[model samples]
Target chain A: MFLVKIYVQLKKDILDAQGKATKKALESLGFEGVQDVRIGKEIRILLDGRDISEVSEKVRQMCDKLLINPVMEDYDFKIMEVEK
Target chain B: MKFGVVIFPGSSGEGDCFYVIKNIINKEVDYIWHKDLIKDIDTYDCIILPGGSSYGDYLRPGAIASKSPVMESIKEFAARGGLVLGICNGFQILLESGLLPGILLQNENIRFKCQYTQVRVENNKTPFTGQCSKGQVLKVAMAHGYGRYYAPEDVIKDLNKNGQIIFRYCDAQGEIEISANPNGSVENIAGISNKKGNVFGTMIHPERSSEEILNSSQGRVIFDSIIGYLKGVTVNGK
Candidate 1:
Protein backbone atom coordinates (compact mmCIF):
# COMPACT_ATOMS: atom_id res chain seq x y z
CA MET A 1 0.00 0.00 0.00
CA PHE A 2 1.07 3.57 -0.64
CA LEU A 3 -0.09 6.86 0.80
CA VAL A 4 -0.02 9.89 -1.43
CA LYS A 5 -0.14 13.48 -0.30
CA ILE A 6 -1.00 16.13 -2.86
CA TYR A 7 -0.77 19.87 -2.31
CA VAL A 8 -2.40 22.44 -4.54
CA GLN A 9 -1.91 26.20 -4.36
CA LEU A 10 -2.52 29.25 -6.48
CA LYS A 11 0.50 30.22 -8.56
CA LYS A 12 2.83 32.88 -7.19
CA ASP A 13 1.66 35.41 -9.73
CA ILE A 14 -1.94 34.99 -8.63
CA LEU A 15 -2.92 37.04 -5.60
CA ASP A 16 -3.86 35.00 -2.51
CA ALA A 17 -6.39 37.16 -0.76
CA GLN A 18 -7.26 34.57 1.84
CA GLY A 19 -3.64 34.05 2.68
CA LYS A 20 -3.17 37.77 3.01
CA ALA A 21 -6.08 38.07 5.40
CA THR A 22 -4.75 35.24 7.51
CA LYS A 23 -1.34 36.85 7.57
CA LYS A 24 -2.83 40.10 8.74
CA ALA A 25 -4.67 38.28 11.49
CA LEU A 26 -1.46 36.60 12.52
CA GLU A 27 0.34 39.90 12.68
CA SER A 28 -2.40 41.33 14.85
CA LEU A 29 -1.88 38.37 17.19
CA GLY A 30 1.75 39.45 17.70
CA PHE A 31 3.52 37.23 15.15
CA GLU A 32 6.35 39.20 13.56
CA GLY A 33 8.88 38.76 10.73
CA VAL A 34 6.25 37.29 8.45
CA GLN A 35 7.14 38.19 4.88
CA ASP A 36 4.65 36.02 3.02
CA VAL A 37 1.89 33.50 3.52
CA ARG A 38 0.10 31.17 1.08
CA ILE A 39 -3.00 29.08 1.51
CA GLY A 40 -3.19 25.69 -0.21
CA LYS A 41 -5.14 22.48 -0.18
CA GLU A 42 -3.77 19.09 0.80
CA ILE A 43 -5.40 15.89 -0.46
CA ARG A 44 -4.41 12.44 0.71
CA ILE A 45 -5.04 9.27 -1.24
CA LEU A 46 -4.38 5.59 -0.53
CA LEU A 47 -3.38 3.31 -3.39
CA ASP A 48 -2.70 -0.43 -3.65
CA GLY A 49 0.38 -0.48 -5.78
CA ARG A 50 3.93 -1.82 -5.61
CA ASP A 51 5.46 0.07 -8.55
CA ILE A 52 6.25 3.57 -7.40
CA SER A 53 6.82 5.05 -10.86
CA GLU A 54 3.48 3.74 -12.19
CA VAL A 55 1.59 5.08 -9.21
CA SER A 56 3.31 8.47 -9.52
CA GLU A 57 2.42 8.67 -13.20
CA LYS A 58 -1.23 7.89 -12.51
CA VAL A 59 -1.35 10.53 -9.76
CA ARG A 60 0.21 13.05 -12.09
CA GLN A 61 -2.47 12.43 -14.69
CA MET A 62 -5.19 12.76 -12.05
CA CYS A 63 -3.76 16.07 -10.91
CA ASP A 64 -3.53 17.40 -14.45
CA LYS A 65 -7.05 16.32 -15.39
CA LEU A 66 -9.08 17.25 -12.32
CA LEU A 67 -7.27 18.06 -9.11
CA ILE A 68 -5.78 21.29 -10.42
CA ASN A 69 -6.62 24.17 -12.68
CA PRO A 70 -3.31 24.89 -14.37
CA VAL A 71 -4.31 28.41 -15.27
CA MET A 72 -4.35 29.64 -11.67
CA GLU A 73 -2.92 26.88 -9.54
CA ASP A 74 0.12 24.61 -9.19
CA TYR A 75 0.32 21.18 -7.56
CA ASP A 76 2.82 18.54 -6.39
CA PHE A 77 2.49 15.10 -4.85
CA LYS A 78 4.56 12.86 -2.62
CA ILE A 79 4.15 9.10 -2.23
CA MET A 80 5.24 6.91 0.66
CA GLU A 81 4.96 3.18 1.19
CA VAL A 82 2.63 2.14 3.99
CA GLU A 83 1.91 -1.19 5.71
CA LYS A 84 -1.31 -2.88 4.73
CA MET B 1 -36.05 33.39 -33.37
CA LYS B 2 -35.89 30.30 -31.17
CA PHE B 3 -33.86 30.25 -27.97
CA GLY B 4 -32.58 27.23 -26.08
CA VAL B 5 -31.67 27.73 -22.43
CA VAL B 6 -29.60 24.85 -21.05
CA ILE B 7 -30.45 23.97 -17.46
CA PHE B 8 -27.98 21.99 -15.45
CA PRO B 9 -29.24 20.25 -12.31
CA GLY B 10 -28.45 23.15 -10.00
CA SER B 11 -28.81 26.07 -12.36
CA SER B 12 -31.07 28.82 -11.03
CA GLY B 13 -30.99 31.26 -13.93
CA GLU B 14 -32.74 29.12 -16.55
CA GLY B 15 -36.19 30.20 -15.40
CA ASP B 16 -35.30 33.90 -15.64
CA CYS B 17 -33.79 33.52 -19.09
CA PHE B 18 -36.79 31.54 -20.29
CA TYR B 19 -39.27 33.95 -18.74
CA VAL B 20 -37.60 36.99 -20.23
CA ILE B 21 -37.23 35.46 -23.66
CA LYS B 22 -40.74 34.07 -23.86
CA ASN B 23 -42.93 36.48 -21.90
CA ILE B 24 -40.99 39.72 -22.07
CA ILE B 25 -39.11 39.46 -25.32
CA ASN B 26 -41.94 37.53 -27.04
CA LYS B 27 -39.73 34.85 -28.47
CA GLU B 28 -39.88 31.07 -28.58
CA VAL B 29 -37.75 29.55 -25.85
CA ASP B 30 -37.18 26.05 -24.53
CA TYR B 31 -35.29 24.53 -21.63
CA ILE B 32 -32.55 22.12 -22.62
CA TRP B 33 -31.51 19.67 -19.91
CA HIS B 34 -27.85 19.15 -19.28
CA LYS B 35 -27.80 15.35 -19.56
CA ASP B 36 -29.63 15.24 -22.88
CA LEU B 37 -27.77 15.63 -26.14
CA ILE B 38 -28.51 18.86 -28.01
CA LYS B 39 -28.88 17.03 -31.30
CA ASP B 40 -31.09 19.78 -32.77
CA ILE B 41 -28.97 22.63 -31.52
CA ASP B 42 -28.71 24.11 -34.97
CA THR B 43 -32.46 24.61 -35.05
CA TYR B 44 -32.19 27.28 -32.37
CA ASP B 45 -30.90 30.71 -33.23
CA CYS B 46 -29.27 31.13 -29.83
CA ILE B 47 -28.46 28.90 -26.85
CA ILE B 48 -28.12 30.33 -23.35
CA LEU B 49 -26.22 29.03 -20.35
CA PRO B 50 -27.69 30.80 -17.38
CA GLY B 51 -26.32 31.50 -13.93
CA GLY B 52 -26.52 28.81 -11.25
CA SER B 53 -24.45 26.55 -9.09
CA SER B 54 -24.16 23.81 -11.71
CA TYR B 55 -22.95 20.45 -10.42
CA GLY B 56 -22.88 22.21 -7.05
CA ASP B 57 -19.97 24.17 -8.53
CA TYR B 58 -17.69 21.32 -7.48
CA LEU B 59 -13.98 21.44 -8.30
CA ARG B 60 -14.55 24.80 -9.96
CA PRO B 61 -17.58 26.96 -10.63
CA GLY B 62 -18.26 25.50 -14.08
CA ALA B 63 -15.81 22.61 -14.16
CA ILE B 64 -18.14 19.60 -13.94
CA ALA B 65 -20.94 21.09 -16.00
CA SER B 66 -18.57 21.94 -18.82
CA LYS B 67 -17.97 18.23 -19.41
CA SER B 68 -21.68 17.47 -19.71
CA PRO B 69 -23.05 15.87 -22.87
CA VAL B 70 -24.88 18.95 -24.13
CA MET B 71 -21.72 21.09 -24.23
CA GLU B 72 -20.41 19.13 -27.20
CA SER B 73 -23.49 20.16 -29.10
CA ILE B 74 -22.95 23.75 -27.97
CA LYS B 75 -19.42 23.61 -29.34
CA GLU B 76 -20.74 22.35 -32.64
CA PHE B 77 -23.38 25.06 -32.73
CA ALA B 78 -20.88 27.81 -32.00
CA ALA B 79 -18.54 26.40 -34.63
CA ARG B 80 -21.37 26.66 -37.17
CA GLY B 81 -21.71 30.38 -36.36
CA GLY B 82 -24.72 30.10 -34.08
CA LEU B 83 -24.89 32.50 -31.14
CA VAL B 84 -24.18 31.28 -27.61
CA LEU B 85 -24.82 33.46 -24.58
CA GLY B 86 -23.45 32.62 -21.16
CA ILE B 87 -24.48 34.61 -18.12
CA CYS B 88 -22.65 34.56 -14.76
CA ASN B 89 -22.05 30.90 -14.00
CA GLY B 90 -22.59 30.23 -17.65
CA PHE B 91 -19.64 32.50 -18.34
CA GLN B 92 -17.60 30.33 -15.99
CA ILE B 93 -18.71 27.25 -17.92
CA LEU B 94 -17.73 28.82 -21.22
CA LEU B 95 -14.30 29.56 -19.80
CA GLU B 96 -13.98 26.04 -18.47
CA SER B 97 -15.06 24.49 -21.78
CA GLY B 98 -12.48 26.49 -23.71
CA LEU B 99 -15.19 28.37 -25.58
CA LEU B 100 -13.81 31.60 -24.06
CA PRO B 101 -10.30 32.80 -23.32
CA GLY B 102 -10.06 33.69 -19.61
CA ILE B 103 -10.84 31.93 -16.34
CA LEU B 104 -12.79 33.39 -13.43
CA LEU B 105 -11.13 33.33 -10.05
CA GLN B 106 -12.31 34.09 -6.53
CA ASN B 107 -13.38 37.67 -6.04
CA GLU B 108 -10.60 39.90 -4.87
CA ASN B 109 -12.16 40.42 -1.47
CA ILE B 110 -12.96 36.70 -1.22
CA ARG B 111 -16.65 37.32 -0.70
CA PHE B 112 -19.83 36.79 -2.68
CA LYS B 113 -21.25 40.03 -4.04
CA CYS B 114 -24.80 40.45 -5.30
CA GLN B 115 -25.72 43.93 -6.35
CA TYR B 116 -26.48 46.27 -9.21
CA THR B 117 -23.47 47.35 -11.26
CA GLN B 118 -22.81 49.59 -14.20
CA VAL B 119 -20.96 48.39 -17.26
CA ARG B 120 -19.87 50.32 -20.34
CA VAL B 121 -20.33 48.81 -23.76
CA GLU B 122 -16.89 48.40 -25.21
CA ASN B 123 -17.95 47.28 -28.65
CA ASN B 124 -21.33 47.75 -30.35
CA LYS B 125 -20.52 45.92 -33.58
CA THR B 126 -20.92 42.41 -32.13
CA PRO B 127 -24.23 40.63 -32.48
CA PHE B 128 -24.73 40.60 -28.72
CA THR B 129 -24.54 44.37 -28.34
CA GLY B 130 -25.58 45.67 -31.74
CA GLN B 131 -28.56 47.55 -30.35
CA CYS B 132 -26.49 49.58 -27.94
CA SER B 133 -24.61 52.68 -28.95
CA LYS B 134 -20.87 52.74 -28.48
CA GLY B 135 -19.81 53.45 -24.86
CA GLN B 136 -23.36 53.20 -23.62
CA VAL B 137 -23.74 52.31 -19.96
CA LEU B 138 -26.11 49.57 -18.80
CA LYS B 139 -27.25 48.88 -15.28
CA VAL B 140 -27.27 45.14 -14.56
CA ALA B 141 -27.26 42.81 -11.59
CA MET B 142 -24.08 40.87 -10.83
CA ALA B 143 -24.07 38.07 -8.28
CA HIS B 144 -21.10 35.76 -8.02
CA GLY B 145 -18.22 34.82 -5.78
CA TYR B 146 -15.75 33.83 -8.45
CA GLY B 147 -16.23 36.68 -10.86
CA ARG B 148 -12.71 38.06 -11.17
CA TYR B 149 -11.50 37.46 -14.72
CA TYR B 150 -7.89 36.47 -15.30
CA ALA B 151 -5.85 35.77 -18.41
CA PRO B 152 -2.17 35.72 -19.28
CA GLU B 153 -0.56 38.99 -20.23
CA ASP B 154 -0.34 38.17 -23.93
CA VAL B 155 -3.95 36.99 -24.08
CA ILE B 156 -5.06 40.18 -22.35
CA LYS B 157 -3.17 42.21 -24.92
CA ASP B 158 -4.76 40.24 -27.74
CA LEU B 159 -8.25 40.68 -26.28
CA ASN B 160 -7.74 44.45 -26.16
CA LYS B 161 -6.24 44.62 -29.66
CA ASN B 162 -8.98 42.44 -31.19
CA GLY B 163 -11.80 44.38 -29.50
CA GLN B 164 -13.09 41.14 -28.04
CA ILE B 165 -13.82 42.80 -24.71
CA ILE B 166 -17.52 43.54 -24.67
CA PHE B 167 -18.05 45.34 -21.34
CA ARG B 168 -16.03 46.80 -18.52
CA TYR B 169 -17.23 47.60 -15.04
CA CYS B 170 -17.88 51.28 -14.72
CA ASP B 171 -19.45 54.03 -12.65
CA ALA B 172 -22.92 55.50 -13.22
CA GLN B 173 -21.44 58.00 -15.66
CA GLY B 174 -19.80 55.17 -17.64
CA GLU B 175 -16.32 55.88 -16.37
CA ILE B 176 -14.16 52.81 -15.70
CA GLU B 177 -12.97 52.99 -12.14
CA ILE B 178 -11.63 50.54 -9.57
CA SER B 179 -14.20 51.47 -6.97
CA ALA B 180 -17.05 50.55 -9.28
CA ASN B 181 -15.59 47.12 -10.02
CA PRO B 182 -17.47 44.55 -7.96
CA ASN B 183 -14.71 42.06 -8.46
CA GLY B 184 -11.06 42.72 -9.21
CA SER B 185 -11.25 41.48 -12.76
CA VAL B 186 -8.33 42.30 -14.96
CA GLU B 187 -8.96 45.54 -16.83
CA ASN B 188 -12.39 45.73 -15.15
CA ILE B 189 -13.80 43.35 -17.78
CA ALA B 190 -17.38 42.48 -16.99
CA GLY B 191 -18.07 40.68 -20.28
CA ILE B 192 -16.35 39.46 -23.42
CA SER B 193 -17.01 37.74 -26.73
CA ASN B 194 -15.24 35.10 -28.76
CA LYS B 195 -13.09 36.19 -31.67
CA LYS B 196 -15.91 35.59 -34.12
CA GLY B 197 -18.33 37.35 -31.70
CA ASN B 198 -20.88 34.55 -31.90
CA VAL B 199 -20.15 33.33 -28.38
CA PHE B 200 -20.79 35.93 -25.66
CA GLY B 201 -20.25 35.64 -21.93
CA THR B 202 -20.91 38.13 -19.19
CA MET B 203 -20.86 38.16 -15.41
CA ILE B 204 -23.85 40.50 -15.26
CA HIS B 205 -27.38 39.06 -15.33
CA PRO B 206 -29.04 40.95 -18.13
CA GLU B 207 -32.17 38.87 -17.80
CA ARG B 208 -32.70 40.18 -14.32
CA SER B 209 -32.87 43.65 -15.72
CA SER B 210 -35.21 42.95 -18.64
CA GLU B 211 -38.57 43.79 -17.06
CA GLU B 212 -40.20 47.05 -16.00
CA ILE B 213 -40.34 45.82 -12.40
CA LEU B 214 -36.57 45.54 -12.55
CA ASN B 215 -36.52 49.27 -13.39
CA SER B 216 -34.05 48.76 -16.19
CA SER B 217 -35.00 47.86 -19.75
CA GLN B 218 -31.39 48.11 -20.82
CA GLY B 219 -31.04 44.37 -20.49
CA ARG B 220 -33.83 43.94 -23.03
CA VAL B 221 -31.63 45.60 -25.60
CA ILE B 222 -29.27 42.62 -25.59
CA PHE B 223 -32.07 40.27 -26.54
CA ASP B 224 -33.33 42.78 -29.04
CA SER B 225 -29.90 42.88 -30.61
CA ILE B 226 -29.82 39.10 -30.97
CA ILE B 227 -33.24 39.02 -32.58
CA GLY B 228 -32.29 41.94 -34.80
CA TYR B 229 -29.17 40.12 -35.93
CA LEU B 230 -31.19 37.02 -36.78
CA LYS B 231 -33.68 39.07 -38.75
CA GLY B 232 -30.90 40.81 -40.61
CA VAL B 233 -29.20 37.54 -41.50
CA THR B 234 -32.48 36.03 -42.72
CA VAL B 235 -33.26 39.08 -44.81
CA ASN B 236 -29.76 39.39 -46.21
CA GLY B 237 -29.38 35.61 -46.55
CA LYS B 238 -25.98 35.96 -44.97
Candidate 2:
Protein backbone atom coordinates (compact mmCIF):
# COMPACT_ATOMS: atom_id res chain seq x y z
CA MET A 1 0.00 0.00 0.00
CA PHE A 2 1.03 3.57 -0.57
CA LEU A 3 0.12 7.08 0.56
CA VAL A 4 0.61 10.51 -0.96
CA LYS A 5 0.60 14.18 -0.04
CA ILE A 6 -0.31 16.96 -2.49
CA TYR A 7 0.41 20.66 -2.20
CA VAL A 8 -1.17 23.31 -4.41
CA GLN A 9 -0.76 27.08 -4.71
CA LEU A 10 -1.30 30.02 -7.07
CA LYS A 11 1.52 31.07 -9.36
CA LYS A 12 3.48 34.23 -8.58
CA ASP A 13 2.06 35.95 -11.63
CA ILE A 14 -1.32 36.04 -9.88
CA LEU A 15 -2.40 38.16 -6.94
CA ASP A 16 -3.28 36.64 -3.59
CA ALA A 17 -5.90 38.58 -1.64
CA GLN A 18 -5.30 36.74 1.64
CA GLY A 19 -1.56 37.12 1.30
CA LYS A 20 -2.01 40.82 0.66
CA ALA A 21 -4.00 41.22 3.85
CA THR A 22 -1.35 39.39 5.84
CA LYS A 23 1.45 41.44 4.26
CA LYS A 24 -0.31 44.66 5.14
CA ALA A 25 -0.61 43.48 8.72
CA LEU A 26 3.10 42.60 8.92
CA GLU A 27 4.15 45.93 7.39
CA SER A 28 2.15 47.76 10.09
CA LEU A 29 4.29 45.81 12.61
CA GLY A 30 7.58 47.21 11.11
CA PHE A 31 8.67 44.14 9.17
CA GLU A 32 10.39 45.40 5.99
CA GLY A 33 11.63 43.89 2.70
CA VAL A 34 8.78 41.39 2.66
CA GLN A 35 8.10 41.64 -1.07
CA ASP A 36 5.04 39.38 -0.93
CA VAL A 37 3.74 36.08 0.29
CA ARG A 38 1.21 33.57 -1.14
CA ILE A 39 -0.99 31.16 0.80
CA GLY A 40 -1.81 27.52 0.03
CA LYS A 41 -2.54 24.18 1.75
CA GLU A 42 -1.46 20.56 1.53
CA ILE A 43 -3.81 17.59 1.13
CA ARG A 44 -2.69 14.35 2.72
CA ILE A 45 -3.70 11.12 1.06
CA LEU A 46 -3.25 7.85 2.93
CA LEU A 47 -4.44 5.38 0.37
CA ASP A 48 -4.47 1.58 0.77
CA GLY A 49 -4.46 -1.10 -1.91
CA ARG A 50 -2.72 -4.20 -3.12
CA ASP A 51 -0.60 -2.57 -5.81
CA ILE A 52 1.57 0.04 -4.10
CA SER A 53 3.23 1.11 -7.35
CA GLU A 54 -0.09 1.54 -9.13
CA VAL A 55 -1.50 3.53 -6.22
CA SER A 56 1.54 5.79 -6.33
CA GLU A 57 0.93 6.37 -10.05
CA LYS A 58 -2.73 7.17 -9.36
CA VAL A 59 -1.73 9.66 -6.67
CA ARG A 60 0.36 11.57 -9.19
CA GLN A 61 -2.41 11.30 -11.74
CA MET A 62 -4.89 12.57 -9.17
CA CYS A 63 -2.68 15.60 -8.60
CA ASP A 64 -2.86 16.38 -12.30
CA LYS A 65 -6.36 15.02 -12.78
CA LEU A 66 -8.11 16.56 -9.76
CA LEU A 67 -5.66 17.94 -7.23
CA ILE A 68 -4.17 20.97 -8.96
CA ASN A 69 -5.19 23.67 -11.44
CA PRO A 70 -2.38 24.06 -13.97
CA VAL A 71 -3.33 27.58 -15.09
CA MET A 72 -2.78 29.39 -11.81
CA GLU A 73 -1.55 26.75 -9.39
CA ASP A 74 1.47 24.44 -9.45
CA TYR A 75 1.63 21.14 -7.60
CA ASP A 76 4.09 18.59 -6.17
CA PHE A 77 3.65 15.20 -4.51
CA LYS A 78 5.42 12.52 -2.50
CA ILE A 79 4.60 8.83 -2.37
CA MET A 80 5.47 6.34 0.36
CA GLU A 81 4.98 2.62 0.49
CA VAL A 82 3.94 0.56 3.53
CA GLU A 83 4.23 -3.12 4.28
CA LYS A 84 1.43 -5.29 5.65
CA MET B 1 -36.58 9.75 -8.87
CA LYS B 2 -37.55 13.22 -7.78
CA PHE B 3 -34.69 15.69 -7.99
CA GLY B 4 -34.57 18.75 -5.74
CA VAL B 5 -33.94 22.20 -7.22
CA VAL B 6 -33.61 25.16 -4.87
CA ILE B 7 -35.40 28.46 -5.59
CA PHE B 8 -34.26 31.71 -4.09
CA PRO B 9 -36.53 34.79 -4.29
CA GLY B 10 -34.73 36.33 -7.28
CA SER B 11 -33.58 33.10 -8.82
CA SER B 12 -33.72 33.52 -12.59
CA GLY B 13 -33.30 29.97 -13.87
CA GLU B 14 -35.83 28.05 -11.77
CA GLY B 15 -38.43 27.67 -14.50
CA ASP B 16 -35.87 26.98 -17.16
CA CYS B 17 -34.12 24.32 -15.08
CA PHE B 18 -37.38 22.77 -13.91
CA TYR B 19 -38.70 22.51 -17.45
CA VAL B 20 -35.57 20.84 -18.73
CA ILE B 21 -35.00 18.40 -15.89
CA LYS B 22 -38.67 17.63 -15.38
CA ASN B 23 -40.60 18.00 -18.64
CA ILE B 24 -37.91 17.59 -21.26
CA ILE B 25 -35.69 15.16 -19.43
CA ASN B 26 -38.77 13.31 -18.08
CA LYS B 27 -37.49 13.08 -14.53
CA GLU B 28 -39.49 13.74 -11.40
CA VAL B 29 -38.12 16.90 -9.87
CA ASP B 30 -39.25 19.48 -7.33
CA TYR B 31 -38.32 23.02 -6.38
CA ILE B 32 -37.31 23.59 -2.75
CA TRP B 33 -37.74 26.96 -1.12
CA HIS B 34 -34.47 28.55 -0.08
CA LYS B 35 -35.78 29.53 3.35
CA ASP B 36 -36.56 25.94 4.27
CA LEU B 37 -33.86 23.50 5.25
CA ILE B 38 -33.57 20.29 3.29
CA LYS B 39 -33.92 17.90 6.18
CA ASP B 40 -32.79 14.80 4.37
CA ILE B 41 -30.91 15.25 1.13
CA ASP B 42 -29.68 11.67 1.44
CA THR B 43 -33.19 10.66 0.34
CA TYR B 44 -32.51 12.01 -3.14
CA ASP B 45 -29.83 11.20 -5.68
CA CYS B 46 -29.24 14.65 -7.17
CA ILE B 47 -29.63 18.23 -5.98
CA ILE B 48 -29.52 21.29 -8.24
CA LEU B 49 -29.02 24.95 -7.46
CA PRO B 50 -30.33 27.32 -10.14
CA GLY B 51 -28.89 30.72 -10.93
CA GLY B 52 -30.27 33.67 -9.00
CA SER B 53 -29.63 37.00 -7.28
CA SER B 54 -29.73 35.36 -3.88
CA TYR B 55 -29.40 37.85 -1.02
CA GLY B 56 -29.30 40.39 -3.85
CA ASP B 57 -25.60 39.59 -4.27
CA TYR B 58 -25.18 42.01 -1.39
CA LEU B 59 -21.66 41.61 -0.08
CA ARG B 60 -20.75 39.42 -3.04
CA PRO B 61 -22.47 37.17 -5.48
CA GLY B 62 -23.58 34.05 -3.60
CA ALA B 63 -22.02 35.41 -0.45
CA ILE B 64 -25.40 35.35 1.28
CA ALA B 65 -26.98 32.28 -0.23
CA SER B 66 -24.00 30.33 0.97
CA LYS B 67 -25.60 30.22 4.40
CA SER B 68 -29.10 29.21 3.34
CA PRO B 69 -30.82 26.27 5.03
CA VAL B 70 -31.30 24.34 1.82
CA MET B 71 -27.60 24.66 1.16
CA GLU B 72 -26.87 23.16 4.58
CA SER B 73 -28.49 19.94 3.50
CA ILE B 74 -26.82 20.22 0.14
CA LYS B 75 -23.55 20.31 2.01
CA GLU B 76 -24.47 17.27 4.00
CA PHE B 77 -25.36 15.37 0.87
CA ALA B 78 -22.11 16.36 -0.76
CA ALA B 79 -20.24 15.25 2.35
CA ARG B 80 -21.90 11.88 2.07
CA GLY B 81 -20.70 11.81 -1.54
CA GLY B 82 -24.07 12.67 -3.11
CA LEU B 83 -24.18 14.70 -6.33
CA VAL B 84 -24.83 18.46 -6.58
CA LEU B 85 -24.61 20.87 -9.53
CA GLY B 86 -24.61 24.67 -9.41
CA ILE B 87 -24.91 27.11 -12.31
CA CYS B 88 -23.85 30.72 -12.68
CA ASN B 89 -25.25 32.30 -9.52
CA GLY B 90 -25.37 28.85 -8.02
CA PHE B 91 -21.68 28.47 -8.71
CA GLN B 92 -21.11 31.53 -6.54
CA ILE B 93 -23.22 29.94 -3.84
CA LEU B 94 -21.10 26.81 -3.98
CA LEU B 95 -17.97 28.88 -3.45
CA GLU B 96 -19.53 30.74 -0.59
CA SER B 97 -20.85 27.54 0.93
CA GLY B 98 -17.37 26.03 0.86
CA LEU B 99 -18.78 23.12 -1.09
CA LEU B 100 -16.25 24.21 -3.68
CA PRO B 101 -13.35 26.66 -3.61
CA GLY B 102 -12.50 30.12 -4.94
CA ILE B 103 -14.62 33.22 -5.36
CA LEU B 104 -16.47 34.79 -8.30
CA LEU B 105 -15.56 38.34 -9.28
CA GLN B 106 -16.89 40.99 -11.62
CA ASN B 107 -16.44 40.38 -15.34
CA GLU B 108 -12.99 41.58 -16.36
CA ASN B 109 -14.34 43.62 -19.28
CA ILE B 110 -17.07 44.85 -16.93
CA ARG B 111 -19.76 44.07 -19.50
CA PHE B 112 -23.00 42.22 -18.95
CA LYS B 113 -22.47 39.62 -21.67
CA CYS B 114 -25.42 37.45 -22.62
CA GLN B 115 -24.58 35.12 -25.47
CA TYR B 116 -23.58 31.64 -26.60
CA THR B 117 -20.07 30.67 -25.52
CA GLN B 118 -17.95 27.60 -26.09
CA VAL B 119 -16.54 25.48 -23.25
CA ARG B 120 -14.29 22.44 -23.09
CA VAL B 121 -14.87 19.51 -20.76
CA GLU B 122 -11.91 18.91 -18.49
CA ASN B 123 -13.13 15.67 -16.90
CA ASN B 124 -15.40 12.70 -17.64
CA LYS B 125 -15.53 10.56 -14.49
CA THR B 126 -18.18 12.35 -12.42
CA PRO B 127 -21.80 11.80 -11.44
CA PHE B 128 -22.97 14.93 -13.27
CA THR B 129 -20.94 14.43 -16.45
CA GLY B 130 -20.25 10.79 -17.14
CA GLN B 131 -21.22 11.06 -20.80
CA CYS B 132 -18.88 14.01 -21.47
CA SER B 133 -15.49 13.07 -22.82
CA LYS B 134 -12.28 14.69 -21.69
CA GLY B 135 -11.46 17.80 -23.75
CA GLN B 136 -14.86 17.76 -25.50
CA VAL B 137 -16.07 21.23 -26.35
CA LEU B 138 -19.66 22.43 -26.08
CA LYS B 139 -21.37 25.78 -26.64
CA VAL B 140 -23.68 26.97 -23.87
CA ALA B 141 -25.40 30.17 -22.70
CA MET B 142 -23.78 32.43 -20.10
CA ALA B 143 -25.25 35.36 -18.12
CA HIS B 144 -24.01 36.85 -14.88
CA GLY B 145 -22.38 39.86 -13.29
CA TYR B 146 -19.66 38.52 -10.96
CA GLY B 147 -18.65 35.30 -12.65
CA ARG B 148 -14.90 35.70 -12.63
CA TYR B 149 -13.15 32.90 -10.75
CA TYR B 150 -10.14 33.07 -8.40
CA ALA B 151 -8.30 30.58 -6.23
CA PRO B 152 -4.78 29.92 -5.03
CA GLU B 153 -2.34 29.14 -7.87
CA ASP B 154 -1.64 25.74 -6.40
CA VAL B 155 -5.38 25.22 -6.10
CA ILE B 156 -5.88 25.99 -9.77
CA LYS B 157 -3.06 23.70 -10.79
CA ASP B 158 -4.38 21.06 -8.44
CA LEU B 159 -7.88 21.21 -9.89
CA ASN B 160 -6.53 21.12 -13.44
CA LYS B 161 -4.23 18.26 -12.60
CA ASN B 162 -7.13 16.50 -10.94
CA GLY B 163 -9.26 16.98 -14.09
CA GLN B 164 -11.64 19.33 -12.27
CA ILE B 165 -11.42 22.38 -14.53
CA ILE B 166 -14.75 21.75 -16.20
CA PHE B 167 -16.26 24.22 -18.72
CA ARG B 168 -13.32 26.28 -19.91
CA TYR B 169 -14.38 29.11 -22.22
CA CYS B 170 -13.48 28.78 -25.89
CA ASP B 171 -13.97 30.62 -29.18
CA ALA B 172 -16.64 29.89 -31.74
CA GLN B 173 -13.96 28.15 -33.79
CA GLY B 174 -13.47 25.88 -30.76
CA GLU B 175 -10.06 27.35 -30.06
CA ILE B 176 -8.82 27.74 -26.47
CA GLU B 177 -9.99 31.33 -26.09
CA ILE B 178 -10.53 34.04 -23.51
CA SER B 179 -12.18 37.34 -24.29
CA ALA B 180 -14.92 38.17 -21.81
CA ASN B 181 -12.77 37.08 -18.88
CA PRO B 182 -15.44 38.06 -16.42
CA ASN B 183 -14.12 38.68 -12.90
CA GLY B 184 -10.62 37.78 -14.11
CA SER B 185 -11.40 34.10 -13.68
CA VAL B 186 -8.27 31.99 -13.90
CA GLU B 187 -7.75 30.50 -17.39
CA ASN B 188 -11.10 31.95 -18.47
CA ILE B 189 -12.73 29.19 -16.46
CA ALA B 190 -16.51 28.89 -16.45
CA GLY B 191 -17.03 25.98 -14.07
CA ILE B 192 -15.42 23.61 -11.55
CA SER B 193 -15.99 20.57 -9.29
CA ASN B 194 -14.80 19.45 -5.87
CA LYS B 195 -12.02 16.95 -5.17
CA LYS B 196 -14.51 14.19 -4.41
CA GLY B 197 -15.78 14.73 -7.99
CA ASN B 198 -19.39 14.79 -6.79
CA VAL B 199 -20.07 18.52 -6.59
CA PHE B 200 -19.96 20.68 -9.75
CA GLY B 201 -20.60 24.36 -10.47
CA THR B 202 -20.61 26.40 -13.67
CA MET B 203 -21.33 29.90 -14.91
CA ILE B 204 -23.31 28.78 -17.95
CA HIS B 205 -26.87 27.97 -19.03
CA PRO B 206 -27.33 24.42 -20.14
CA GLU B 207 -31.07 24.37 -19.44
CA ARG B 208 -31.63 27.28 -21.84
CA SER B 209 -30.37 25.29 -24.80
CA SER B 210 -31.85 21.87 -24.09
CA GLU B 211 -34.12 22.46 -27.05
CA GLU B 212 -33.41 23.44 -30.65
CA ILE B 213 -35.14 26.78 -30.05
CA LEU B 214 -31.99 27.93 -28.24
CA ASN B 215 -29.71 27.29 -31.27
CA SER B 216 -27.58 24.66 -29.54
CA SER B 217 -27.94 20.95 -28.97
CA GLN B 218 -25.08 20.54 -26.53
CA GLY B 219 -26.66 21.13 -23.11
CA ARG B 220 -28.72 17.97 -23.05
CA VAL B 221 -25.68 15.81 -22.63
CA ILE B 222 -24.88 17.54 -19.36
CA PHE B 223 -28.15 16.44 -17.84
CA ASP B 224 -27.87 13.09 -19.57
CA SER B 225 -24.65 12.45 -17.73
CA ILE B 226 -26.32 12.94 -14.37
CA ILE B 227 -29.13 10.65 -15.30
CA GLY B 228 -26.62 8.05 -16.38
CA TYR B 229 -24.81 8.34 -13.09
CA LEU B 230 -28.03 8.00 -11.12
CA LYS B 231 -28.95 4.92 -13.06
CA GLY B 232 -25.59 3.41 -12.39
CA VAL B 233 -26.00 3.99 -8.68
CA THR B 234 -29.40 2.29 -8.64
CA VAL B 235 -27.92 -0.68 -10.42
CA ASN B 236 -25.03 -0.90 -7.97
CA GLY B 237 -27.12 -0.34 -4.80
CA LYS B 238 -24.64 2.05 -3.22
- In order, candidate lDDTs are 0.91, 0.78
On the 0 to 100 scale, the lDDT of residue B161 in model 1 is 94
**Mind giving the per-residue lDDT tens digits that candidate 2 earns over B130-182?**
78777777878888767778887788889888878877787665566556443
Best by TM-score: 1
The CAPRI class of candidate 2 is incorrect
Which candidate number maximizes lDDT? 1
| Candidate 2 deviation (Cα RMSD) | 13.2
Task: Please identify model 2 stretches exceeding 4 Å from their true place.
Answer: A1-84, B180-183, B233-238
lDDT of 1 by residue, B134-160 (tens): 899999888999999999899999999
DockQ of each: 0.62, 0.02
- What's model 1's lDDT at B113? 96
